[model samples]
Target: GAGVSQSPSNKVTEKGKDVELRCDPISGHTALYWYRQRLGQGLEFLIYFQGNSAPDKSGLPSDRFSAERTGESVSTLTIQRTQQEDSAVYLCASSLSPVQPQHFGDGTRLSIL
Candidate 1:
């Protein structure tokens, strides 16, 4: 693939709802990352996956946030009991390795009412 791909580019939900955001990294990429960007704020690293090894999920802000990736392909980020503060852009990026530059996909815009 030419770049990372995210589905349902926009999402709207009420408080307490749960949402799932999906990411498909570029083929052959071995490293994937998830980030959150609140309105007018900088990106915050959320999770990272490298190959089939254990993912680095320490950056997840709460127990409600989780992510999983299989191999070097698709990954899904799930948020439980969504709140107004949870509204933000969820970004996905992929790189050849941990030290390499990453290519990002258009983020999933989440809105909570």
Candidate 2:
């Protein structure tokens, strides 16, 4: 299949609301990752899922952020109590392995109004 895919290419929500973002990784890819990029900043790692292993959530900046991946296919990132600080582009990437390079999708631009 092609590279990772993210839905709702753009999102705008009110503050204190909750939002969910979806990601579909490349077929047969065993490693998937989520990242966030604020305006004028570099991408920040959010979570990583590899095979059946537990996802790495340490990179999630706050308890309001969480992610889950079923197997190696689709992954979702949920943000609770949206804030202006949460406004950014959410990106998804997939790799054949942890050691391999990742291919990223066009990020979902999120705005908190």
Top lDDT model? 1
How would you encode candidate 1's per-residue C-alpha lDDT over 1-113 as one tens digit per residue? 48999977999999999999999999999999999999999999999999988999989999999998987899999999999999999999999998999999999999999
Q: Please give each candidate's TM-score.
A: 0.97, 0.97
Model 1 bad stretches (over 4 Å):
none
Model 1: weakest 10-residue lDDT segment is: 1-10
Taking all chains together, the TM-score of candidate 2 against the true structure is: 0.97
lDDT tens readout by residue for model 2, 1-113: 58789988999999999999999999999999999999999999999999999888879999999998988799999999999999999999999999999999998999999
What is candidate 2's CA lDDT for residue 85? 98
The alpha-carbon lDDT assigned to residue 15 of candidate 2 equals 100
Backbone collision tally, model 2: 0
Clashes of each: 0, 0
Clashing pairs in 2: none
